[model samples]
Structure formats: structure tokens, C-alpha cells
Target: MTPDTATPSLPPTPPSRRAEFRFDGDAREYFRIWIVNLFLSVVTLGIYSAWAKVRKKRYFAGNTWVAGANFDYHGNPVSILKGRAIAVATFIVYSVVDNFFPKVGYALLLALVFAAPWLVVRTLQFNAANTSHRNVRFHFHGRYPEALAAIAPLIVWPLIGIAVGWNMSSLPASGTEFFILSMPFIAFAAVYPRVVGALKLFHVRHAAFGEARFALDLPMGDFYRIYIAAAVGAFGLLIVGMVPIALMASLSPLPGLMVAWQAVYLGVAAVFLAYTRSHVANLVFNQARMQGGVRFVSTLTTSRLAKIYFGNLLAIAVSFGLLVPWAVIRTARYRASCLALESDGEMDGVLAGVSENVGAAGDEMGELFDVDVSL
Candidate 1:
């Protein structure tokens, strides 16, 4: 060793590249799993669904690997359960107050609606608190800011919808009127995701991650492209499919043919929705990555890994829906497969040094909890 005093060479590092995302499963399988989970959750009156969601998420996280590193769903079950409880309590209070005391309820409803901005922020915080990287925890501290940013648009857009609906009602009856009335809802559909994405970026930045920082690079243009594409494609398909129905109505019994046509239409619509979701998810993941000192090493796309998802779904559907437990497992696996990352040319793992202080991790039993970020 002394005679050959040359230092040993380190392994070459992989080159950095723009991250890509895709699903890991086919359609049929994904649908099958979804159906099974759907059935079980329904049967259990949603109690089982909560656990199902966790299992599914865990599976997806585990399967989703990035640059040879895998995501781990370390989200605490108790936290999620507690969150669910809060959501349920909120819903029950709203329901009871709204039903029993109309005047007070109406006032409260207005206040809640106004507080939509805050509600949205809290939702992000709760979600972020549950989402972790490695053993490091994450929390959402940017709620107020996100709420403030969302306030103007969230209130304005719905009012715009009501206005459009009112105006459309005044128009002479025709397809034009129908289209006008639907415009506000359509506008909301298009604008909501982008706003949420922006807020999410803001939220992520507030929750510090060691040297790494979360940033949203949402291409509003590309984001819009997805909404537009989905809307146009789905609508176009519906129109084209209707031509057959119109022809059949003239040539055959109208009622039966119409029913058959509707069934087919729904089937096609479901597929379209699935593909649209996959596309949108892919776009969002690619756009949202680490910035500043943070780097992403790889990514997994919803489109590419869709096969694994489809298989999971099929597994769920095949077992007379008893495979619902495994549905979450499959979902977690599929999601795990789709995660990619961006990073500097180093073999250090994607989330190697990230913080992991996921607040309190036990059941919500009246324990005082404080999320410390200075650590």
C-alpha cells in the first residue's frame, strides 16, 4: 500500500437531468382496485376507508422510487385518524346548526364561506404535517399567507359563477343559455387547481427542509393546457358519441337505444377522467421540485407507472372486493414507483438530510402539541 500510494478513485456520479413523471399501471387494473376499495369503504360506512387510504398511500409511497431511493409513507395513522375526526366534527356541527337554526345557520354559513380561505390553509397544513420524507418530518406553517392569497380568487370566482348563472337564466332558452350558465363552474374548475398549486408551493416553502427547500415551478400555461385538453377531449368525445345515438333514435326504438348510448357514454367518460387525472398529476409533479440549495435526483411519472396501478386495481376487483386491504398496498406501491428526483451529481439520497419533526405522533388524547421549526 505504501509502494502504491495513489488514492483510490470514487465511483462516477450519475448525470443530472430534468425530472419526468408517469403512472405505473394500466386502466382496467386501476379501476378494479378503485372499485374494490370503493365497495369496502362504502360497506364500512367510511371507517374502514380511513385505514384503507393509509394502507394505499403507504403502498404507493413504498413502491415509488427515485434515483434508486424509495419514498416511505411514515405518516402516522393516529394523526390521520385525528384529522379525520376533526373534519367529521366540523361537518356535523355545520350540519346540525344549518338544519336546526336557519337564521343562525345562514349567518354561520356565510362566515364559513368567508373562512374558506382559512379552511383551505388548514387543510394544507394538516396534509403537510402528515406527509414526511425519510425520518424527517414536515409541517405547513404558511397557512395564513396561503389563505390571504386564495381569499380574493376563491370568493370572486364563485360570485362570478352565480352572476353568470343569473345572466344565462335571463337568456332565451337554447344550448347557448346552457353553455352560459355552466361557464362559471367551468371557470372555477380551470382556475382552482392552479391556485391550489400556487398555495401549495407557498406552503411548502414555509416548512423548512434543512438545506433543501420546496418550490413550485407551476407553468400556469401547461397547467391550463391539461384542463383545456381534458375538457375539449371529453366534450368532443361526448358530441361524437351522441351522433350515433341520434342516428339510432331515427332507425330504432329510441328508449332502449338511448339507455345503451348513455351507458357507453359514462364508460368513456370515466376513462377520459382517469387519463386526465394522470396527465395533470404528471405535469404538477414535474413542475414542483426543490429549488435554491435543494436538488431533485429523479422522478416517477403517473403515465409510465400506470401499469402497476392498473394491476393493483385489478387485484382488488378480482377478490370479490375482499382485496380492498391490498388496494392501499398497491396504490402505495404504484405511487412509490412514480417518484423521481432532482439533485447535484452525488450518490447521497434524494431526501438524505431533510428534517422529520412530524409534530406529535400519538393519538389525539388531549396532549398539548407544539411544532418546533428551529431544530
Candidate 2:
């Protein structure tokens, strides 16, 4: 309508804000805490490690800030300790079974297979319940059926391998037999990327920050493409690395060639690891959203990430692992710098409705495996 016939105008929508993500942690401060934790853990024969983990989580969460508010971790050390004890006990039992009763090892193995999905689901729920920003906690609603489906590869692949090799009463006497036995393992390797992608989907897609759940439409097709690209890149790097080594072997001594081969292999592995991590981070963050209007951005470059990893490795080695606290802090800070959240409104408002506590049992897998996915 023209101005003559128009009613009162409404206010314009506010432009979105780019919420800054910052890490307020200081290496010196963390180092002091780390050293104390280490000493206490050792003094207590690793029992204090439970409390140490809680402190470490609290430290990181307390220091991480977005939209002028720091996040918080409310995980109990007692729960974590209990989880660790359970994990250790299970490991001991599994080890005993493998050592003494080879056939019964399958039963123990199947036990773990059935337990994997539950552990993962609980771990996600627990960690999400404990983590909070603006007094509201995140939550994970992944169910056992969904989790089982998502983690089937980890469960089924091993079972298939065991089934295929269960009759290995003696070493394979023929090449054909050896080839037949290895097929299950080969198939597992081929499907491993898909399994990882499924896990990522389960962890990320099921997460809810307040009432607004996360949505990631990263299909298996997309995930497979990313993995395929990374694999091809790694293979190319390996080929490139080996070509010169093969040609120059004639000019180098046997020991020198061996050293060169080792160096090339390690270098390729490092580069591949860095490349995949950076690429995956950028891909996932850019594609994912919390609610509809809240999105994430990642500026992590492969070169930058690789440098951080290489530097951290060197520094840790140089310090005989004493400087590990510094390395951890350094990596945390840099990674924080690479991420920013763009949202249509205040984040506190978005988080207002999402407050929850999943409980100690929810994060057992995280506590047990130390899978820290703080993004």
C-alpha cells in the first residue's frame, strides 16, 4: 500500500550478532593446577585421578566464554571415579577371559558389543546434562535403539571378524585360507569410515541446548564423501612421499634409507591426521545449527591445526611431558579462537528454555573414554 493508505509501520528486525567465543584460561594458572593434580593422583595411586578429571573439566568449562558468559561443568568426581572403577574392573575381567579361557573370550567380547551402544548413549546424556551455559544445561535424547543402529558397525564388525576366525584352531596352512580369514577384517576396515560418520551424527544430531535441539542433515553420503576425500589425499601424500624415497634408496645407505622411510611414514600420518581433523571440523560446524537461527562457524585451517599439533608434540617431548598442561591450554585457546557463533538473538534467551540435568550415568562413556567434544 502507498503511504496514503498504509497503516502504522512495524519496527525492523534486528541484525544478527556474531557471538564471540573466548578462552580465559591462563597456562601458568592451569599448570599450577595440573601439577597439583598430578602429584595428588600419583600420591593416591591414581584414585585421585577421578577428582583430577573433574577439576580439569571445570577449569576448561569455567574458562570458556561466549556472549559474555562462561560455561560450567557440574560433573561429580564421585560419579566419575565410580565410572572409572567400573571401566577398569571390566577391562580386568576381559583380560582374564582372554588370558585363561580363549573360547569364553567370545562371550566377553559379545558382552562388550552389547554394552557399546548403552555406554555411548549414557555418556552423551551425562556430559550434556553436566555442561551448562547461562545456568541452562544441554541435553542428549539419543535412545538405545537409535544408538544401537548408529553404533552397529563397531559391534557387528568385530562379531563378524570373530565368527570368521573362530575356527582358527591352528595357523592357516594355505594362502587361500589366510585370505579367507582376513576378509572380515578387510570389510571392517572398508566400512570403518561410515561407522565414524554414524557416531558423529548420533553425538551431534541428538544434542539439545535447551529446548532447541541441534539439527545436522549430514547424510551418510556426505560423510562418506568427506572420508573418501581425506583418504584419497592421504593416499596421494603416501605415494608422493614414497616415490622420492624409492628413487633415492640407491644413493643412500641401508640405515639411512630405513630412517628416511620411517620419517616419511610418520610425516604422512601426522599430515593426514591434521588434514582430516581440520576439514571435518570446518565441514561439521558450517553445516550444523542449534535451533534454526543459531549457527556455528569454524576458521580452522589444516596448516594451522597441523602446526599446533606438531608444536604441542615437540613441546611436550622437550619437557618430558611436564609441559603438557601448557600444551593443552595452548590447543584449547587456539581452537576457541577459531570458532564463533552467529545468532539471530541473544544466546541467553535461546538457552533459557533448555535447562536440564541428564545425570551421572549419562556420561559414563565420556568419562571412561575421555571423549571431550567441546565445540
Candidate 3:
């Protein structure tokens, strides 16, 4: 061979690289899926929805590439159908009981409340167990007690707090007193962040990518600070944001004050939702770690998130929610852009072993309960 010692034309790859999340899914591609889903769902009287869901999830998961690899969904639509059938049956039973046997229906409703924890656990177990990355499955090890505790703030304590707040507040004689009396309701709203944070922490801690488990170790004080700041900031900013609406309401005899007030309420709700979402992502992503040297980083800001969130909502509303696929894709792409995975080595090299196949019962149950504990 000739003595050719010149450097190669192409540069060598970096020794190590952080696994950045990049979603390749586009609204156009998902719109096809969405349109088909809608057509089949309507034509088949919603029987094809099970398969539609599978297709949609598969498309999203398949397109969300991280470090040049994508995820896969192995859920069977038949199983999903079975679960949906059960859910429909349950709902029908509840309705029938409520119509024909009011007392039994009331008892059933109360029983469902107690059953919420079990429902949560089943859904978590189903969802985490089915989702896989690089051929390694994830698992959720959360028990019923843990599941119940995760959502206690929202479901269990609100009623108690309401009664306590009412008893503590004296009868109001003026608007100022009414506002003061409403402080307890404001406090109730404040509990949302804590509940959201706790649920996220619990879910993240229990999630395992193969055998590499995740750990979240932020201080409790920091958790409170995030939520309190968001709650205060949300309401405070809402008050300030209402200035323009107030101007409009006062400017004309257009009967705009009621509309302005409604906008204010929605704006306040959005602010709280946006702030809570932002803090939650920051807290979970910035503090989490896998069993190996793998860690997470997220930089999705509240302002950016709020813009995207509202835009998606508006798009869906304008399109009569036929654009839901686009909305989903938009969210996935933006959120993916905000996430990065830092590992000691190659992403898949950290996997301990393959997880065994699990049934779809829990997955369907999770779907039934509308549990959004996805990572």
C-alpha cells in the first residue's frame, strides 16, 4: 500500500454524546392518522377507535427518536378493546343503578372513590410495563398505598379543608370580607401544585428503564417553593393581565364585563396550569437520575410552554378538535426538544436486561382512569 498518512476526509465521531430527545413527527403525517382515525371511528360507530389509538401511539412513539433511535409500542388493540368494553359496561351499570336504584348507585359512587387508589396502581403498572425504549421495557413498582398517597391532596383533603375553612370564616358583611373569606378557596387551589409534584415524584421514582431505576432527590422545601411560587405568580399575573380586559369592559356599553370576567377566569386557570406544568417538568427532569451514570435535563420555560399550550388549544377548538393529532404532535415535539439524557456511555449499554411481557389489563385500566403519569 502507498504511504498515505493524510488525515481522513471525515472527522471522527465524538467519544461521548448526550442523548438529546428529538421528535421527527410532523402534523402532516399525524393528520393522516387523525383523519383516518376519525373516519373509521365514526363509520364503525367507534369500534375502530381501539385500533386507531394503537396506530396513533405507535406513530408518535416510533417517530420520537432519541440519540438516533426510536421507541416502540407493543400494545395489542384487541386487549385495549376488551378494556374499553369493560369500562363501558361499568359506566352503563353505574348509570342503570343511578336510575333504578338510587341508594345503591350512591353507594357505588362512594365505593368508586375508595377504589381510586387501586385504579391508579393498575393504570401505572400497565402503562409503565408496556412502554419500551431500545428493546428494554420499563416497569412501575408503585403499590396501592403509594398510589393513594400520590393523589391525596386533590381527592381526599379538599372536602375536609372546605368544611374547616367554612367553620373558620365568620359571616361576611362586605365585598372585602367576602374576598377574605374566599382565602380558603385560594388555599385549596394552592394545594394543586403540591399534589401534582408529589404524584410526579412518586411516578418518576418508581419508573425503571429496564433495570436502571430513576431517582428523584429534591428537597421537600424546594418542592413547596416551586408550587407556592407558581400559585402566587399565576394569580398575581392574572390580576395584572385583567387590566386590558377591564379597559375593554369599561370602555363601551357592549356588555363585555361578563365576557371579560370569563376570560379572566380562563386566563387565571391557564396561568396556574402553565406555571405548574413548567415547574413540574423542571423539577422532575433536572433532579432525576438512573441507576447508572445517566441523568436528565429539561429547559422548557413557562412562557414558551404557555404559548404552545394555548396555541394548541386554540387550534383544536377552531378545528372542532379534529386537529387533536396536530396538537399532540406539537406538544411531543416541543417537550422532546426541551429534554436531554446524559449518560456515562451509550444509552442502551446501561440496560440490565429485557423485561418480561405484561398483559394490557392495567394499560386499559390506566386509559380508563385517564392517568397521565407518563414520563
Candidate 4:
């Protein structure tokens, strides 16, 4: 064969660059801001909380850096205030009606349950729209229908269980009657992992950083495995933790017994919560991918997270919450340290996407209702 006819070798692949997330927030600096925010909110009778929220988010976002770029928050204080006002009004109405008309209150509760999915969608959209990195805004395109579909199992089964139990109580109780009443709840528990997986998938896939879409192909089995393992580990830890409590109860006075019980409870809770949080976060982030050859990595450890969480609890208890800012900083720093963005030398090539204005009413209402649907 002629020399020109010989096959040429392929070019070598570019090295993958890893940019770890960094939080440069100073505890002392944040404490000053936090104190001012607290004082102002109290003085204003909580009306200033909207401004406080924006300031806090901006501070955190500005401090969070990755790949030589820091994040920015562009939330409007007026919008947030409007949202808070609406939330307050809704709460007042609910309280007043619930006090005067029990049946109407139940009906309103049902309405809220159905409206939850829409509120979650709006909350996600509003938060994403307000956050930016390197001048490129993030966006969430999830819709109410999608949100409802993703979480239907979680909502429906519990409602079914309640309805069943309510109606069954009027009938004569039999051996299988309890099981019949409990079936919906058991089903709900069994499907919880799948529902969570679905929600995460919906959240990640619908999100975008600029025009580049985020991706996640996490398996349902991963959620189940993590939760099951955490449950078993928690049970084991609870047994071990309770041994000292049991002994103290047998020998110690009432006050000491209460203290021992509380300690054991907090310890078990901290360990399990940390385990689930770390493992799930690592799994979700490590599996997440984005357009432009970008991917994610998370190295969160159960032991480290548990230490921070448990220590935060102890510190708050001892300092009467003066160390809240410090605890927040520590947790943010650790979480940032554990996460990274991996790219194949294309970080500078990604372009910004267009974003629209989103209202903050859903966000404030979600907070007031204790509905945390954030990703």
C-alpha cells in the first residue's frame, strides 16, 4: 500500500476539567447582615421579611462560585412583599373560616391539596428565573399538569386512606377492617420512592441554565435502595442509641431521663437524616448531566453531614440560636465543597437563554404552607 493510503491516527481527546463549587460566605459577615435583617423584620412586624429574604439570597448567591463565576439573585422585593401579603391574607381567611365553619374549612383544605401542585410549579419557576450564573439565567419550565402527575400518587393515596378510615369507623370493626382501612396508606408508603423519583426527574429535566437544558436519568431503584438502607440503619442506630437512655431512665431522675431521651432522639434523627440527605444528594447530582458536555459530581459523606447537623443542633441549643449564622455558613460551605461541575473544555461556549418575569406569590405561599418542592 502507498504511504498516502495508510490510515491516519485519531486526535487525542481533551482532558476533562472539574470545577468544584465554592462558598466564600463569612460567618461574621453574614451574622451582621442577619442581625440587621432580624431587627428590621421585627420592627416592621414581619413586613420587611420580603426584603430580608432577597438580601439573604443575594448574599448567598454572590458568595457561591464555580468555574471562576459567581451566582446572582435577581429577586424583586416588591414582588416578594406582594406574595407575602397574599399568603398572609390567605392564612387569615383560612383561620377565620376554620374557626367559624368546620365543614367549609375541610373544603378549603381539599382545595389547597389540589392546588399544591400548581403552587409548587410556580415556586420552582420563580426561584429559577431569579437565579443567574455568568450572566446566564436559570429557568424552570415545569407545568401544573406535569407537577400534579409527578406527585399524584403521593397525594391521592393519602386522601384515599383518610376517606376509607373515616367511613370505616362507623361500621363494626373486624380483623380485616383495619387492613382494609390501612391499605391505601401502605400503598402510599410503598410508592413513596417512585413518587420521589418521578418528582426529581420532573424537576431536573425541566430546568435549564441559560439555553442549555439539564438532564437526569436516575433510576427508581436508586431511591428505593437509599431509603430502605437508611431506614434499616436508622432502626439499628435507634436501638443502640436508646440503650443509654433506657439505662438512664432506670437509674436517673425525671429531668435526667428527659435529657437522655432527648439526646438519643436527636442523635438518631441526625444520623438518619444526614445519611438520607447525603446519599440522595450524591446520587442525584452525580447522575445529573447538562447540555454542552457538562456533568456534575457530588461527594457528600454521611459522617461529615451528620457531624455538622448534630453539632449545629447542639450549638443552637447552647447559644440560644446565636450560632445560627455560623451553622448556615458551615453547612453551605460543606455542601458547596462536595459538588463540582465537570466539562470537556467547553465551559466558555455555553450561551445565555431568555427568561421571563415570574411572580413570587407561589414561593411565599409555599413557605407559609410548609410545602418544600424545591430541587
Candidate 5:
């Protein structure tokens, strides 16, 4: 056939490239920073902790690289300190009222319960706004309504249980009462996976790097199956662990048996936690997508995570917590190594969006109160 008459071939598909995350922070270097931060925080009566936190976050963020570009933290220490002062004042008032006026304390607790969802949204916004990669700022558009929707079930179930327990003395001592008391727990467990899925959806879908929003196209059933599988595995391990614990208890002294019991229980708990964290994170990250033909991949293994946890525990015990910086660095390294971003084209194709300043109160409050505002 003539060359002009031959059918034209289609263009070849663009090759996809996977870039693993990198952490260049050294443990020894971090330890020096950590020790200084600790000493200053102590000397300042914890007022300098806000600056210390900023330094620590900057160190970690500056060292974390993806696609040959490192991230940066732009948080203001003054804003963080202001937030911390407010949080501390609130805590002090709550503590004093609870000690002197139990009824008023309950009212304050209720107010806090309602305010938590707002704090969660603001915390996410602050963290995202302060984080930048390749000069493009990340942002969180999550609002109070979405956060409330995600957390309402968690609050409701516990409130129901509390209501029932409050009236337990008045209720009849029958199987009906027992069933009624147990219903909240059963309902909570049944909805826990879906609640978690909603939280993840709210978290990922509202996150934006530049002008592009992240997407999670996963079914709630996937989360349910993972949680159920983790629970069943933990129960099986617990049963197996109990056998050894029982034997040791029967054959050993009281103190030895107590130690054995604690060891077995802690081991089971750690295994369960490792499985949930690794599997849930892997599923969420692997299913997340962004613009410019980019997607994420996570290879977090439960066994490796469990080993790390146990090793960290042992090292912390041996070093009297002096090895904390080492533990933190190693964990960060391992987690980064397990994660990668895949793209069919250049990552620079995505355009940047306007960077807006956000308040640090939510971030500081969440940290002060040990609230889980993490995405």
C-alpha cells in the first residue's frame, strides 16, 4: 500500500510516574532542637511552647519533600500564643466551676460539646492555610455543618447512654432495662464505620491544593468492612492471648500475673490500633484523587507499624524518653516511605489559588484539649 493510504497510528499514552515522599530531617539535629525547645519551654513556664511548636513544625515541614519540592509552615507564634492563652483561661474556669459548682460545670460542658464542631473546622482551616508546597498554599473549606454532621452520631450515642444511666435507679431491674442500656453501645458500633467514612469524606473532599479540590470516591461499605475485619481479628487475637495470660496467672505470683495481664492486653490493643490505622489510612489515601491526573498511593503495612510502635515503646522506656526525637524521626521516615503521588503528566501543571490567612485559635485549642482534628 502507498504510505499516504496507510492508516495513521494513534499517539502513545503518557507514562505515569510515582514519586515517593522524602524526609531529610536528621534525628540528632532534631534532638538538639527538641532539647532546646524543652529547656526554653520549662524556663518560660510553658509560655514559650507556642514558639517551640512553630519551630518543631517548621523543621518537620521544611524537611518533608514531595516531587522534589519541600513544604513550609507559615504559622505565627503570636497568634498561637493568643489561642493558647484563651484555651488555658477557658480550662481554668471550667476546672474551678467543676470543683465548686457542679451544675454550672455541666452547663459549661454542654456548651463546649456544641462548640467542638466549630473548633474542628477552624483547626483544619488553620493547619491547611499555614501549610504550603511549591509556593502554593493548601486550604481546607470544611465548614461547621459538615463537621457537625460527621460528629453528631458520636455525641448522640453517648448522650443516649448517659440519659439511660441517669435514670437507671428509677427503671426496673429486668432484661428490658439491660437491653435498653446496651442499645446505645450497639447502635454506636453499628454506625461507627459510616461516621468515620463521613468524617473522611468531609476531610478529603474539602481540601484544596491551589484551586483544585481533592476527591474521595470510596463507598462507606469499604470502611465498614475494614473496621469489621479489624475488630474480628482483634477479638481472635484477644482470645488467643488470654490463654497464655491465664496460664501465667495460674502458675506465677500476683505481681507477675499482673505484669503478664498488662503485657497481653497492651499487645492486643497495639495490634488492633495498628491494623485500623494502616488499613484505614491506606484505603483513604489510595482512593483519593486530585486534578492534573494525579492520585495517591499508600503502602502502610500493619505488621511494620506494629513493630515500630513496640520498638518505640521499648526505646522510650530504656532511654527515659530521651529517644523521643529519634522515635518521631523514624516514624515520620517510615510513613513517608510508604506514601507516593502518581501523575500522568508533570505535577507543575496544576495552577495556584489565592492564599488566605486564617486564625490559629482552633489549632491551638484543639492541641491544648487533645482533640482529634486531624485529617
Candidate 6:
């Protein structure tokens, strides 16, 4: 009793090899926060989405951690607002010009539309540059060259379509004629994303990084496969449902019941599509690697994805659609949980950190600011 020499107990060590994911709390809690915020946002129209975006960024940043380091948002929220404002202003100005100076306006709109890819790339870079980690930051240099390369084909594609439309009048109206006329454009559009993504990855890889080299792998085949699968699955659903609907309609007492059934069928189909898309994205991202040959591995299975999709749907249904906020929270957590490191190790948790300046009201709408850094 004179000297209690019992060794002090230590906290349990997290698994050395654990899935890479970031989220500390249950999905339901986040869902609740999302709901309350969403309601306030809807009541105020779109102003709330901005505030909501800030809150969401904070929540996700605060909850996510990478490689034992928390991620932070160093970017200014005002920058996002500014960018959005510019985009809106540009759109309005373009509209007015097109309306007042028909030919000139058309040319200007065409030019702007052709430059759409560059605009998107710049926006992404700006957003990425705003994010930092451990006070150190990542920057996104504009990939103008790649953007221009991608845009040229996009601009030309419309001309091809117009030509086809003009010539169609002379061709016999047959199924084969339609397919022949459209197949090339369809194929081009289908393959365009992969081509553009590969170019973008190449540019991003060469971009500057702080103390680390940036690199990205372009798994074109896998990327295209996932998209094709989604498109095909959606088409398959539609085709499969038609038979059942036709049979049901023949036997149903009320004609209107077919319409209701169609609605239900479409709703279910949409949920299926969402679940499949998420699953495919998780799988693809997990398999893709960064510069250091560090491959990502996702723990999300088809069943788990289905559960998440249905869970969100149930939440929305139960709350008379008021639970959308909560559902989004759960959705994010589910996705985060599914994302993990593929390497062998016991997993503990993923961490994300975000530094933000809240206004006097502690609300995102009240002149909110943030700086994000991810590890």
C-alpha cells in the first residue's frame, strides 16, 4: 500500500494496417445536421446552398484524416463565392449580347461554349490551390494547352451533327440510316471523357507540388468500362421493365394504375443506378494509384452500396423528404468509410481537418471563411 507500483495502462494502439477512410461519427448524426441546414437553405432559396456548402466543407474536413494527418481547408470561402459570381455574370452578359447583337452574340456564345473546358479546368485548379495541408499547400496550375486540345474536337462535333441533320432529309427514313448517321458521333461522345481525362491527368502530373512530385495514372479502359456499364445498365433496366409493364397494363383494372406503376419503376431504377454508379466509382478510385505507386482499395461491396442507397431513400421517405439533410450526411460517411488503403495494415480511422473562420453567428452565411489542407 505504501507504493502502488502497478504499470499505467496505455490507450489501445490503432491497427498498423487499416483501410484509409476519414469519418469519426455515425452517419445519422451528420444526416440530422444536414437536414436542419437544408431546411434553412430551402426557405431562403439558393443563398442557403452557399452557407450549406461551407458547413458541409467544414464537417467533411473536420472529420477526414489521411495517413494519420488531418486535412484542412485553407481555401477562402469568399473565393468560391467570387468564382460563382463571375460565372453567373459571364452567363448573363453573354445572354444579353446574344439577344441584342444576333450574329455577333451567336459568335460570342459559340466562342464561350468552345472555351467551356478551359473554364472548368481553371475552376478546378483554383479550388485545388486553395486547399493546403500542414500549413503547406497544393496548387493547381491551369492546363490551358490540354483544355484547348480537348475543346477543339468538342467544338467541331456540333458542326458534324449539324451536317448530319442537313443531309438527313435526302436519306431514306430507315432505322439503318439513323444508326449510320449517328453512330460516329455517338462513339466520339462516348470516348471523349476518357480522352480528356487522360490529357488532364498528364497535365496535372507535371504540375508543381510542395516537397512532393504530383503524378496521376490514366486508366482509360477501366474508366470507360465503368461509364459504359452504367449506361448499359440503365438501358437494360428500361428494356426489362417494359415487358412487365405491358403485361401488368393488360391485366390491371384501372388505366391510371399503369402510370403509377411506371413512376414506381422509374424511381426504383434511379436508385439502382445511383447505387451502381457509386459502387463503380469506389472500385475505380480504389484501384487507381498516385505517384508513389500507392494504390487505393475500397471496402465498399455491392451489397453495402445498395444498403446505403436504400438507407438514404428510407430516410428521405420517413421524414416526408425533410430528412434529405440527414441522408446526405449518411451518404458522405458511407462513401468515406468505403474508401480505404489497399495495403496490409490494421485500420483505425481516417482523419480530415479544416480551418475555418466563422462569423459572429457561427453560421456559414455570416461571412464564413475557410482554409483546407488534406493529408
Top TM-score hit: 4
For 13-98, candidate 3 gives per-residue lDDT tens digits of 54655878999998888889889998999999878988998898889889888877888887778877887787777778988997
Q: Compare candidates 4 and 6 on TM-score and give the better one.
A: 4
Question: Sort by TM-score, best first: what order?
Answer: 4, 5, 2, 3, 6, 1
In candidate 6, which residue ranges exceed 4 Å CA deviation? 1-19, 25-51, 97-106, 150-189, 192-209, 253-284, 291-293, 310-320, 342-375
Identify the runs in model 2 with alpha carbons over 4 angstroms from their true place: 1-11, 177-181, 246-249, 254-260, 351-375
Q: For residues 240-273, what per-residue lDDT tens digits would candidate 6 score against the true structure?
A: 7667777777887577767766655655565555
Q: Which prediction has more favorable TM-score, 2 or 5?
A: 5
Model 5 Cα lDDT, one tens digit per residue, 151-183: 887777656665675577788778798789888
Off by over 4 Å in 5: 1-7, 161-190
State the TM-score for model 5. 0.91
For residues 199-293, write the lDDT of model 4, one tens digit per residue. 88988999998898999998799999988998899889889878877877778657767777788788888988899888888888888899999
Backbone clashes under 3 angstroms, per model: 58, 5, 0, 0, 0, 30
For 50-129, candidate 1 gives per-residue lDDT tens digits of 66666666655554554444455665556656656665666678789868875566566556556555555554444455
What lDDT does model 5 reach?
0.86
Error of 1 at 30 (Å): 13
How well does candidate 1 score on lDDT at residue 138? 57
The C-alpha RMSD of each candidate to the native structure, in angstroms, is: 8.5, 3.0, 7.1, 2.6, 2.7, 10.0
Residue 131 lDDT, candidate 2, scale 0-100: 87
TM, every model = 0.63, 0.89, 0.81, 0.92, 0.91, 0.67
TM-score of predicted model 2? 0.89
In candidate 3, the residue pairs with backbone N, CA or C atoms under 3 Å apart (3 or more residues apart, or in different chains) clash, namely none
**Poorly placed runs, candidate 4 (over 4 Å):** 1-6, 157-191, 251-254
